[model samples]
Target: MSHRFRKPVNIMPTPTIDLAGPVAGIDTHTDTHTVAIVTETGKHLATDTFPTTSNGYQQVTEFLSAYSVVAAGIEGTNSYGAGLTRHLIGHGHVVFEVLRPTRALRRRDGKSDPVDALAAARQVLTGQALSIPKDTTGPVESLRMLQITRHQLVATAAKLLTLIKSLLVTAPVTVRQRYATMTTTTLVMTLSRCRPPADVTDPVNGTLTSLKSLATTYNMLRAQCDELDNKITDLVEVINPAMTQIFGCRAVTAAELLVSLGENPQRIRSQAALAHLWGVAPIPASSGRTNRHRLNRGGDRQANAALHRIVLVRMRHDERTRDYVQRRIKEGLSKKEIMRCLKRAIVREIYQVLCLGRPVRQSSGLRSDEFRALRSKKGLSQTQVAKKLGCAPARISDIETGKRRLSELKLTYEEFLKTA
Candidate 1:
């Protein structure tokens, strides 16, 4: 018979979910929320609304207290419903911070507020939603605030530069004459001194005033940002001193991991799980003759960015990482594939770092049973693993203990994520 390709059967038509207990479904909004109490039997016992305020919080607490809420699942936990989540979590609630239902889910069942809420709650309760990453510690919370402010200030500064460029592109030659190429400060000063060219009265001067106001505010924000940066820097030095010792792991990468992972890394159970959270893991997509995998595009973009920075730094300075890339190139893997493998290998490095119980030194002895087991299982000696991961062998110590693991513990919601 001629070879005939046929569509492979999907072993499982759907994802498996074995929810243990009752779950509360909450659809969070800026001003109001829709909450539904769902029983293990999949019945909605109660549905109600609460204002996004303290009194509303009290109302929710009273309502939630009546039922044995195994877990409360809320969408937008990081943004609109953050206050509500904090309130619930503060009251000893296991809050499953779920992503909003996908359009596929909505279309699959048809859309409605109730449907969305139920999907979110059930999704999380079933372990499909997993959870979002958040920090309850004071230092981590402070670091997050600082990062937000710093990022905002930097973005504003970038916008100012963009505006200056756009202005030059559109301005007439008279304005463009010599002042166009001036630096922002120089341009601001020159414009301040020009006096509107008399007859024209400088319509752009009014615009310039607004831009200058933005610049002044930008300066204030920059100062605030600088203070925050200093505080974060100090915090990183104290918390992740070993991470700083790694040649390619700069302060920014260190800060991101510190703020993202906080003092505890056990919150994320495994390095594989952590890789998904960092958006560095690859997912296989294969059926019959077609076989391929793709880099995960879902995760904390911020943490992913930090990982990229580390990789870039290592590529430039770390001989081991550079050589690995070169070898991978010789082996016929594309540059992107080489980087992806390096990133996953970083997870292994993270595992080793957390295992050794020492600072991030190039080589640290691993005499403990745990260390031996880990190394034996991976089939790499301490130094070999350290070199591959671009980290110190001493870091392997922290990886063994609960001191460190991976940053940003949120997993992706890919269709094929079990391998990850």
Candidate 2:
């Protein structure tokens, strides 16, 4: 000590770590959340359970604050973990949607909240979690709510209509005879207006009362659905007018597509990614000699249904779509195969227009010279072509002159010209 007094030595304090690659994993439930913190090296630091309240979310942030979090993996981000995910996101945290452990993994590890949370953390640490959670704090969320409500209302109305029909089928002769000849709209109107006796003791009165109640409820639900439809249409048009303008694409189908894309469409990455997400992309199932792809049954079924709806409508109404169908059929592609091809092509077009920020050009899959040459060879006049296609002559003229955008109409018109 006497020797050291001659020259004092300064000791440096340990530097505080700003962040050490700590990742948080949360297994969220309705009432509580099981959270685990792990480091980059896959060391589980701590696991804790917190209530799913604002105070609890705050407490969780405080607990994780001890070690600055680099990222978070959250299970059920669209369900139970939604609130926590939003909270974490608002607090400037990078969050990834973590799928639940596979049954095989769960069987091996045994199941518990702490174990699941720890597994999630470790998955994040190991770079297993990849999907970014949907941001629900936007107009897209409002559209989703409206779309879901309308869907439920429509379903309920359909069930009610079915039940009413069933009841009438078994009703007393007089009641059955009265409704038998009425169309669905007339039946609903008549049933809703019926004034059954207060005493439901009689079978006729009981049936009448039931029909009245169900009809009225169905009408109400139908009205609500119409209102929701209007809202959805307005919102979708405001969000992406080009999507609505696509042949056979209605607001409801567009809404489903938007919901699947989430608030950030860029997160979908590529056209192929979008096609895969919507189940339009085929999955490879190839072997040594037989190389093949199978229908993808795993993506967003709702979006897939939307695409199917669009395809069905286009097949029935769009001139170009009909032409494609005929060509594909002639080329030995079955109806199902043709549908798949159309969906894939539509997805590609949508991706180009929406995600790639390309101007929404009419997808005229035709060369003007070839189309004109085919028409000239067939000796079909533009007016005759317009009449055959049930379109304006000006439309045909514009198509020939390249003044108007026509989506795939050339093949159909050309086919008509050849056959004429």
Candidate 3:
């Protein structure tokens, strides 16, 4: 018997019902969301709970129509409240991201959904919650999803590698002697090709079977990660090639920055704001006699990590950066201080590329299409070019089609074209 399975459809929300003015707030959770409507003067008008779903979001909007929502304060605009935030924004209601109430505040006010919701509303009315949530309906969103998946795949592969090594430690003597000393790639390949008995009653066979399964999983995840890397590179190139072209800013790093900036980069007012968002901005810890700044520990940690990577790479490979590091060290700055300064400078450069919209780097003074035309004029096929360059033909095709960016290869290709 064949059973046909159909996908569930999303019912599009209708036009929002209009009403008189009031502010709203929502306390969101995994299964349900609590909504509190408050008047202009901070008086609670109504409180209601709705399921966290398409229909529930729609109902919440309808319920809010009882009073015209001037602004809605929502916690977790990037997590549990994401769907509702999008729904509210799509319906033309202004939304503000509300921070969680502090423990002291919670203790004073008493904790409850209605109380929290009203707090959010009151925060908005008082102009406390001011941040506009990231607009996720853009290419940056796609990059974020890809980056997240790639991070998970890499993490899973790492764990599998660790598990495989751990298993080998306790593996049978013969098995350990046979496979333990190989490099990761070799070990995975050897284990993946292992032929253990179908019945795993024997300890040796059980270990071998487990190793084989884990090795295979590791290989699969690695392949997925590679595929995702290609996608990320292409997408980041599209979003802002200039960003990726910056020294030490690869596709993954660029994607992290773009995700943090969101689709609407303009919303990030200045380089200082950008630095603050990446947690690179120093916080003043001044007193009557002592004046010092401390490292900021807030903002998107992933973005901060990306900045750290860029600073590290530049410190190693970039001559100017190295010179700056030395100069800072001579000026009584420690390695940590040097890194912080570099991160701030890097943020400024990033701001120029992402927010100021720097022009994309020209590959050997030609666009992808122009480069392809130049190759055609030279009467050389992609395979011929790839062979001459000692790379795969697919790589040549990807570069020519703008699916990949190999700066060195492109320069070499340009020289080859000129000679041909």
Ranking by lDDT: 3, 2, 1
Cα lDDT tens digits for candidate 3, 54-137: 999999889887677877889899999999999988987787788877798899999999889988878777664357788988
> How much lDDT does each candidate structure score?
0.65, 0.82, 0.83
lDDT of 2 by residue, 109-165 (tens): 999999999889877765643577888988898998898898888888999999999
Give per-residue CA lDDT, model 1, range 1-420, as digits (tens).
011223322211223344566778888888888888888877778888889999998788878888877778888877788888888878877776676887887779987667778887677656664554364545666667777777887888778667755765666565566666678777655554444433335656544554455556656666776787788787766665676676577666667765666445555655666776677766566689977665579876787787777788889977657656886788788887777777777655664454233555352223223554656665666666556556676665455452543232101111111222
Candidates 1 and 2 compared by lDDT, better number: 2
In model 2, what are the clashing residue pairs, if there are any? none
Between the candidate structures 2 and 3, which one is better when assessed by lDDT? 3
Top TM-score model = 2
Model 3: runs farther than 4 Å from truth?
Answer: 1-20, 360-420
User: Quick one: how many clashes does candidate 2 have?
Assistant: 0
* Candidate 1 segments whose C-alpha is farther than 4 A from its true place: 1-21, 166-224, 259-264, 350-358, 363-420
- Model 3, position 82: C-alpha lDDT score: 92
Candidate 1, which ten residues in sequence have the lowest lDDT sum? Answer: 408-417
